[model samples]
Target: MGDPTPTNPQDETSTQPGASPAGWWGKLRDRANQLRSARRLSRWFNVDDDKVAEILAEVRQQLPTTEALLVGKPQAGKSSIVRGLTGVSADIVGQGFRPHTQHTQRYAYPSEDLPLLIFTDTVGLGDLAQATDAIITELVDDLSSSSSKGRILILTVKINDFATDSLRQIAVRLRQQFPTVPCLLAVTCSHEVYPPSQAN
Candidate 1:
């Protein structure tokens, strides 16, 4: 009988431990695809619908997502905060926000497909023409009530706009519903409160 030989650890032909040759090749192909993916959607990297969906599916599997719910009236600096957080131009922020819920619009930082942070802004809040209850209910439903790390609330109120009865009600109800999710108060439009003599 011929003597048995040991597999060489440094052999270039060796497959990974417990992995078949086909499986090892598949893993290599997947890694190559991920490496080729554009970090952001831009002139340098334009992602098609299929590519975006694929990237998003992979990202959801790999990352721990955190949702930031921005509850505020119209023009209450929600977009401003998103701009600051994302460092995207106003044009991109304006275009990026898409319908999340009936009364909420969401923007994912970096790129929608590869987002680490997500911001959901209430669109119909404080508008006389729209019913705020539906919005509140929708926001409540959107809460990731299980994990405190999964979500947080951002309540924005214009500094000079004291008609906060609605905003206050929303904040109180959301806090009660999801006591675990911490709420942050952002008083916007402070420039209106400050005199011209005051430095920024």
Candidate 2:
């Protein structure tokens, strides 16, 4: 982005009078030039650690990111939704997730440094022993603490799976807590409703 301004073709320094005369002297001159270039490069990048961190923080603040929280039972296509949103391969999406809490994982699209969207996956949303109240509390705390404004909740449920008594409770809790946050109902596994011949 920062291209050097062009110098005049007639500029004196632009023209090296001649190639170095061949000898040990030429080799020594080349070595010295290499060292000078290296020093210049090093000096250019010799920024203070604190200053670098400050710049990175500013960049983070400037980049607008949407945060999506995916809450669903097992095999509900939460991972597939992430893959669809990011337009990346499933394996890459699978590997990108980093643990956010005891029961949640986070993934930032493109990169953590400059993400356009960040997704938080609730790991144990519908487990029999899992406490949904704790999950709801954690989500509320996270949403309140986050600097991001664009927050959403995605509820993934398999189309054929009607056993949602537990899932419904969680959805109600989240809606009551974060009324402003938009929610999406992602119904998946339509193949489960079709016969074997039509499933393909």
Candidate 3:
């Protein structure tokens, strides 16, 4: 006891405690597991397998129906969404205002047995005088004559500076024209401007 031995018990790594060590097979198994994880991560560069699986699930759940109209202003992306939903690339619709829809464009969903949904693109409200009147007239005539069930009208508009008289006036007229029918108003270009619900 010439010099007191300083025993630092806190230094656990410095002391060789009697513990069982992992064998060679255990180390090799851990390395293989790490390599497998790295390979799985690397495979995601070309395509996302998770997203593909999700889309396929969505396609399976989607039910096809044939009673609706896509009504919106010009260049409001109605055509784009219609094409996407229907899974068709061809010209399902023509651009300009046609006097009469002799052949109302029908966009078909997958599954041959499913009924094809017809999308009638009406002219922009601003493009014609009393557009609400024209639209209601067409819708009434079509529904009355067709063998199909009642249709749903989906109205799309760009959300921005809606204080103008055009939208307010149109809304009033539409309410008057089809008081009993159901209407769905969809606001597009929402990324570019605030939605009406958030507006002050």
Best by TM-score: 2
Mind sharing the TM-score for model 1? Answer: 0.68
Scored by Cα lDDT, where does model 1 land? 0.82
lDDT of 1 by residue, 60-119 (tens): 777776788998888889989888887889999999999987788988877776677889
Question: How does each model score on TM-score?
Answer: 0.68, 0.75, 0.45
Query: Can you list the residue pairs that collide in candidate 2?
Result: none
What is candidate 3's lDDT per residue for 1-200, written digit by digit as tens?
48897777666544444322545556778889999999998886666879978876665447444566666666776776676666665463333223455323344344323444656665555455545556556656665664534566676777763633544454555557656556777777766664667853
Q: What is each predicted model's overall lDDT from 0 to 1?
A: 0.82, 0.85, 0.58
Q: By lDDT, is 1 or 2 better?
A: 2
List the candidate numbers ranked by lDDT, top first: 2, 1, 3
Better of 2 and 3 by TM-score: 2
Score residue 78 of candidate 1 by CA lDDT: 90
Error of 3 at 113 (Å): 11
Most accurate candidate by lDDT = 2
Q: Output the better candidate (1/3) by lDDT.
A: 1
The residue pairs that clash in candidate 1, if any, are: none
Ten contiguous residues with the weakest lDDT in model 3: 95-104
Q: Which ten residues in a row have the lowest lDDT in candidate 2?
A: 12-21
